[model samples]
Target: MRELPYDRLKAYEGQPVATAGAGKDLVNEPMIRHWCEAMGDANPAYRGPDAIAPPTMLQAWTMGGLSGHTDRSGAYDELFGLLDGAGYTSVVATDCEQEYPRPLRPGDRITFDAVIESVSERKTTKLGTGHFITTRMEVRADGEPAGTHRFRILKYAPAARMTKAPERTAAAGETEAAEETEAAERSKAPGQPEARRPRPVINRDNAGFWAGVETHRLLIQVCGGCGTPRFPWLPGCRGCGSPEWHTVEATGAGTVYSYVVMHHPPFPAFDPPYAVALIELAEGVRMVSNVIGVPYDKVRIGMPVQLEFLRVDGEWELPVFRAGGGVAG
Candidate 1:
């Protein structure tokens, strides 16, 4: 491995990266609707005559789109070039956090200024050895303070590929004995404990949804004011801005609205090449969950599926959709 220029990277920290970068479009209904649909956010406050953009969509309004931003400072580009020159050429977004002071409304022009928040020392991770670079942007709505978005990305050289060992053939008697042991394990008592998988981050807004999952029921939130049903429950209705809402049990019947086959960066808790789907339930709401009971390549949009409570581990149960009547082991 080549030595990374840690001092040069750390020196760029706290520098201004972009100034007065503007969003391509003013806050408008069309873009808001598209965002809400894609996110499956059905807050009444995001619709109707008086609607506010989803607070989590703070960074969306500041996106430069395909043509890129003209106001981006050379420092930002230089920082990336330095990393690339150091052989940390690949980049992947790790996560982002945002805080919104006020909701964005239609006709509000969006502008932002960003700074290189911090550059971490070179660290080793599952993806590879890399530096984590963070940027913080202050977003304004028509010159008024609206929100702040902090984004982080990992810049790293690709991990060395693992070489597979040659397979060894076993004798007939040894193979039979191995098969017998496997069968015995499978036929063991169902009460045996299993390894626990990662748990979901449950917060005040989505605790109820997880509680419902524990009981093997799929619940969708319904606004009391406009009677709009929504998935991935929100505190208020996006269509009517109603704070009061109740839950309705989903029929567990849905169709795949969109999907992606995950094949890279395998995790310990999950196998790669699995299908993750955005399912549109019969209740007119959509939610993201794994689509099991079929091969990853077979999961297509509009495929009919039924809800199944999947026991991911001994302690956690998640709601995953099973394609057709086939069940996942």
Candidate 2:
């Protein structure tokens, strides 16, 4: 299979996150109750037909919640620029810290702003790995300070290829296309907005998990509700009535139930002819993961899979399922 490409961690160093919009619409009562119940915080104050938004509900809002903005266009542009210069390598999110001042309600007008708090020196591990951390913060509901969060993102630079370029070049063209190959290997930092394409803000909830991937762990929600398992970490589970659930360790063993190879993925980090997979664990649960351990041309159906934590962006290590079963050949 095609190896995942390099990811950029400090893609937005020189620009703003541009969190503008009118906020998520919380219309249906059942939906509000659905969220509240998931948190196991079924307070009467949050119950009625026009119930309030639960405390933990705001974290996932960037995917689809409301305040006063509906876009992250400029933010994505900056990210691509950063990633390009940093090498098309793996990026991931590793940690997050949050503080909430006011509880989010159904009718609150929320606005958010994001900024990279800092970027640290890159470190190489004992395993011969290179990585760094970029921390960012997002705060909502300006006047009252609804919520504030800081995410420590992790990213890795792949092992540099020792392949050499062609012979020396002069204006007389003594080189054999080596300059072109050498230039291609170099990362490009974006100097202008038009230098790159835009994507969506991955949001804070799953953002942490994405970073966790680089740390080599499969972090999932151990539902506070039904003791069921959930991914894309949220405050509660949709299956049962518990809200106190937290994260637990996963062995990352599963079977491939479905898979798709993308010749055209919208994300720049992904290469063409790649496979996005649906893996069903022995526990009877399925997760959306990418299958490795085979060529994109060699990927097969029903392949046994295990989890792999790869550093995608910043400190976030992503847990993508690999096709092979163990650590050795």
Candidate 3:
């Protein structure tokens, strides 16, 4: 394989990638509601007469959507062409950071400009060998600076795909010898445990949510001030900013609103090609969890699912959605 031209790639740093890019729509309530519904964020502050969009939704206002923006400069395209020519055809967003200087209210006209901030030297990662490209955008609301967004993505050739070894039938005599060897190995290393799944980080805001999972109950937070319910528990109502809240048990009924099948970069303690779904509960909030009792390919939008507790390992139990009563083969 030809080596990546790192010095040539880095030469595009500090160039203008996008300028005078205007949003397709002004900040509005409908988009805000959709984002909140998809994220299971029911902060009361996002609703009602005096409301502002979520701070995290800063980039949403600037997206060009399916048609893309005409204001994008050729420098960005040329940089990507250089990487693709070197066989780094695959790309994945690595991280993003946003800072809000003012709230984005409804009816605010959004515009932005971006610069190619930097490019990193080629590095090997678990996913593959890649270079990280960073971009910084200055967002404006009604021609005044509102926030800054910094995004980074890794462009790389995908790692070689892994294949399973073919199975071979063992002769009767060979099977006996293999059984004896396995018994001896087990005796030598008793109870070899598998790696644990990554644990959820519990903080004061969402600690109660995990505690409820421990007892096999799904809890949603209800705000005391506005009487609104939210999932993935928050400390205060996003709508009213009231800190007082109570818990409500979920009814365990929902439908698959959207889903994705994970099939790459398999991890220990997890089987690949499993379906992770965004479930829209009957209570009008959405949360992400795994879908079981059905093949990953069979899970579809609007599929009925019931909440169920799954004991992943001895130490962990999680809430997962089951497609039906019977398990899929």
| Each candidate's clash count | 8, 55, 8
Rank order (by TM-score, best first): 1, 3, 2
Q: Model 2's lDDT to the true fold? A: 0.54
Q: What C-alpha lDDT values do all the predictions have? A: 0.77, 0.54, 0.79
Worst 10 residues of 1 by lDDT: 180-189
Tens digits of per-residue lDDT for model 2, 202-245: 67566656455546666677766567777657655555545776
Report the C-alpha lDDT of model 1 over 207-277, residue by residue, as the tens digit.
99999999998889999988999877889876777899999998898889899988886443444556889
Clash list (residue pairs), candidate 1: 43-237, 43-238, 43-239, 44-237, 44-238, 44-239, 44-240, 45-238
lDDT of 3 by residue, 1-329 (tens): 35766789889999998989999999999999999997767677898999999999999999989998889999989999988888888898988999999999999999999999999999876456888999999999999999999999999877543333232333322322233222212212124333345578899889899999999989999989998888768877777788999988988888888999988765434446668899988777889998765556788988888888766545666788777422211
Error of 2 at 48 (Å): 6.5
TM-scores for all candidates: the values are: 0.72, 0.41, 0.67
